[model samples]
Target: MGSGPSLLHREDIHVVIAGGGYAGIQLAKSLKNKARFTLIDPKEMLYHNVGAVRSCTEPGFAKRILMPYAPAFGQNFKQGSVTAINAAEKTVLLSSGEMVKYSHLVLATGSTGTFPGKLPDEMITVAEVTQKSEAVLKLVQEAKKIVIIGGGAVGTEVAGEIATDYKDKEVTLIHPRDKLVNGESSDAFQERLKEVLQGLGVKLVLGERVTNLDELPTDRVETATVMTDKGTEISADLVIPCTGLKVNSTAYKDSLASSVEDNGSLKVNNLFEVQGTERIYAIGDCTNIPETKMAYRAGMHAELLAKNILAQETGGTVKEYKPDPFIMVVSVGRKAGMGQKGSSLLPEFVVRMVKSRDMGTGRYWKEMGQKPPR
Candidate 1:
């Protein structure tokens, strides 16, 4: 059995997870019979952002991705933003003026990114997300020419999803680097991604910087002329900025005696524990794990952290978390994608089955102990 029944029962071994994201939810779920857990987050639902880019094009997808924490976690889940961490006192200060005590602390606070890729930073409810999805779908439907200012995973995915779904729409992807995936992926994988996107009629503008990118508005989809640094002008009806992510590690700064990296990531040891603290640990995009900040990688972190935490409690063999090699599965649209693991690129069929088909929503729904909608 999971921790649902023993959530409030076992107060002695209480585990407080700061962020109810991919890593946080997985960690809490993995500690089924081990400890009682309280998951804290500002949002009511766990937005499966891996599939968020696709949601822009597909209608009613936002409701499918935005999963509530109530089903699996029940009363143990606390809906609030973690304002600060009182490490000395072992309590997490919430924005709701509530102090949640913990015997073990896991800082799984994930990073923040722009809309359609990542949700808005403000506190969100399920109803609001559904409304936003409908609005974005309408925006995509009306847009004849779409410009995505970033050729990263989010940007490429956005371009692919929009272009694939609406063949009449002119989709252009702009990236600062000469190659896609920021030169992090293998040569073959990058080439494949470019080929697939181009096949879908996505215009690629590589090795060019969007000078007026910061000035562009992200709130509402608008008709504007986007100018690049190289004097190229593109008229766009809808401009989506895949500006990347910023780590949310403010709560760890004041109370915890640990070094926060210049990139705002928490420095964690090989055991996934914060450098200075024994009981306190950090994982996911918020930790300097030297891996791609993907949802799957965060899930991997939770799996290991759960075992290590159990080992510490039982005085058993504690294991070290070795950073996995750069493994990525970039879903282009429903039918096409590219992926890489170590030096080898994944098969197109594998990519389609694993990610491109439904953006792995079914798998995640199962992981969260819920049934995927038919």
Candidate 2:
């Protein structure tokens, strides 16, 4: 009864979701019986991107990192790269040379990266995740020295995961800033993170920049040696860049009616509706939501968008989105993490219990109506 022949026979109030990320699928499942939904993305599997850092280092965990979408969504899920979106007409064009029409559209194509933040560019299947995860593990296994650029959440967490798994390897973390995790966190939290990472044998090279990536001498595609701004030369068998998120915003450029942000996200009103548009809404990393881009925030946005859309259908008063206090967490390794929940520094045990134990992937699978990997 979730989605199949019975649902297809019903009349269409088509809701086409342009991405299979957390926001897109959450809205689709929440609005299950309320509308005819079509969720589209290029990858055959919906990614638990947060777990990729640890999964890359501990390749055995790859089995728990990916889930195919077809099982959860049935026939309503479409696997194809969205080439374009016609926001005015509420239609999406896929790479399969097919056009999907909709009465409502929600764009939630979350940010991606060139590194472990997302899967490799050519990888689109669950099997590819496993294969590439093993390849990444091979890189970790083969390298005696590892260099991580940026001291943000992903970079720091990756460093910890690698150090935890391979204690013999020399791991160096370089950042231009004086402290790690500078955004939306306190100095106490930053100091604690520094202490934890340093205790794990991660060399913290702070307050300096690795400014010349192109000039680095490469031993291989995975290995390089570079000079820092302070004239220190560091050589590593593997270099990983977790610089930041790059919003995937080019697809809807023509359709967004000149309201796209310079950073490749759409500008939206407080209700999470795209500015100057009525039927079209935007959420998650693809929107200028003014909050730190986190999975929980995206889930809240999806719920709010669904509620407002449902209200618009039934002629009821639409509810505005009011977010809970910001909670920030970083999974240092499989059993360790650091976090702050609303101005209180969470204890290490609390961080491990909440996120680092399994990276919140089980809860995500539960919401998606799938069994977690054993």
TM per candidate = 0.95, 0.93
Range of the 10 consecutive residues with the lowest summed lDDT in candidate 1:
1-10
Whole-model Cα lDDT of every candidate shown, in order:
0.83, 0.80
Assess the local accuracy of residue 163 in candidate 2 as a C-alpha lDDT between 0 and 100: 91
Off by over 4 Å in 1: 1-11, 214-221
Across 1-374, the per-residue lDDT of candidate 2 in tens digits comes to 23322233446578788888888878887777666888988889878887878786765788787878888889889988777877667778887889988888888888878557776557899888787777777778888888888888788988999998899999999988887865678888888888888889999998889987666432233556766899988888778777767888756877674778888899988787778776778888898877778887888889778777766766767887766776788988887799887888988998898788888888888878999877
Report the Cα RMSD per candidate: 2.3, 3.0
Candidate 1 per-residue C-alpha lDDT over 186-297 given as tens digits, one digit per residue, 9 for 90 to 100: 7788878888899999999998988887666455667788899899999887788887689987678666644688888988888887887758889899998777888888
Off by over 4 Å in 2: 1-12, 215-223
Candidate 1 similarity to native, TM-score: 0.95
Clashes of 1: 0
